[model samples]
Target: MEIGEDYRDAVLPQSRWEKRKFVRCDFTEADLRGLVTQGCTFEECDFTRTDLGESKHDSTAFRSCVFDRTVLAEITWTGCSLLGSSFVDCRLRKIKVRETDFTLVSLGRADLRQCELSGLRFREANLVEANLSGARLRDTDLRAARLLGTDLSETDLRGAKLDADALVQAKFTGARVDLDTAIAFAAAHGLIISS
Candidate 1:
């Protein structure tokens, strides 16, 4: 379904509705805070600069949605499906995403500092230029995910399976790593250190 032509300045309310279906709608610069949007379906919608703070989104499906500059601080997402979704330049600090399916999602230039994302499967996802400093990533599968200019400083990657190609342009300064991986990283990146 094609979206409305003047959907940028449109303001939709979700105070009464629990499970709202937003299909092909544009929510640019909209305020959607303190709402319970459980099990909502948002397909092909543009959520640019929208505020979704303190919202309860459990088991929500957001496919092919563009979340450019979206303010998603202090949101709790549990059992959500975000396949093929793009969140460019979004603020996502202090968010907890438990048991979420984020396959093939792109989160470029997003600030996810100090977020908790344990055991999340992000296969083939693009996390380019994303700030993931001090985040929890224990046993997470980051296979085939892009790390172009991504800041992973102080991130926990214990037992996290990641391919070597995914470490391209990933900054892990002061991060915790094993001995074997540290040697391999220094060798692969061509560094000259003292003993």
Candidate 2:
């Protein structure tokens, strides 16, 4: 267990941690590339300007953490929980997520273009002004998520669950959707559909 520890600018590459607990830890500008963690919990941790590239986490929990300008390229997360975590200006390219819960997480203005986001839950997540162009959201749950000014252009939303009211607020230019989603979106905007 690590509590209130400061690891700023520390280099801990390729470290493996399991079932460890961290509370209020500051990893600002730290180099944690290729780190692997399983069943680890990090609460209120600050990852400002940290490099966590190529890191892999399984069943980890990051509650109320802050990731500002962090490098998360090629990171993989499986069955992870990032509840109330906020990511701002983070580098998230080639990130793979599976069955992750992002409930109440703030991803505002994050660029996630062409990312594969299947079977993930984003309930009540703040995705305002985020760019999700060409992203595959198949079977993803985004209920009650804030999508105001979110760019979903050319994004595949098949089998994705989202509220029609939320969908109306997002930009859906060239977005692919199922018939049920299309009908619900049209009805939410008071559009009359004729059979």
Candidate 3:
């Protein structure tokens, strides 16, 4: 389906975007805060440099979207599916994502402090230089994902697996882990501790 640019001009008000499909549209630098969209579909759209901060979405699906340099701070997402999305240089602080599927997403240089992500699938994601301080990552898969220069202080990796080269710059202050696992994991990363 071909999407028109004029549709972007119309007001997409909050609390009224359920099961609507907006494909191949340019939403760059758009102010979409506080917009509550449930079960909506966004395909092949460009949300680069967009301000989607503090938005609430439920069961929304975004496929093959380009969100490069987007500001997605303080967004609350639930049961959403974001497959094949690329988020380079994106900032995602204080985000609440629950029951979401982020398959094959590229989240390089993303700031993810105090974020809560539960039952999420981050398969094949590139999280380079991503800061995840005080973040909750339950049931998150980081297989084959790159995590160079990533800061993860106080992050909960209880049921999460560390991907290849995914802990280069991960910090673990105020974090909890099993002693054997902690010592083994940290030691493998050349982490030095004082007596």
Q: Give the top-scoring candidate (lDDT).
A: 2
Residue pairs clashing, model 3: none
Error of 1 at 89 (Å): 2.1
lDDT of each: 0.79, 0.95, 0.74
* Each candidate: RMSD: 3.8, 0.9, 3.8
Number of the top-ranking candidate, with TM-score as the measure: 2
5: Cα error in model 3, Å: 4.2
Q: Model 1, 1-195: lDDT tens per residue?
A: 344444675455455345667788877887777656677888888889888877768888889988888888888788998999998877787787899988899987778888888799888888888888998887788888888888889998776767676554689887776665676577667776569
User: Which tens-of-lDDT digit does each residue in 1-195 have in candidate 3?
Assistant: 447453343334343577788889888777676778888899989888777778888999989999877778888889998898988877787778888888888777777777886458887777777777778875577666667777777887776766535654456667655464466576668888669
Residues 1-195 of candidate 2: C-alpha lDDT, one tens digit per residue: 999999989999999999999999999999999999999999999999999999999999999999999999999999999999999999999999998999999999999999999789999999999999999998889999999999999999998998986778999999999989999988988999998
**Candidate 1: clashing residue pairs, number:** 0
Candidate 2 global Cα RMSD: 0.9
- The ten-residue window of minimal lDDT in model 1 covers 1-10
Q: Model 2's lDDT to the true fold?
A: 0.95
Which scores greater on lDDT, model 1 or model 2?
2
lDDT of 2 at 32: 99
Task: Give candidate 2 misplaced runs (Cα > 4 Å).
Answer: none
Off-target runs (Cα >4 Å) in candidate 1 are 1-20, 178-195
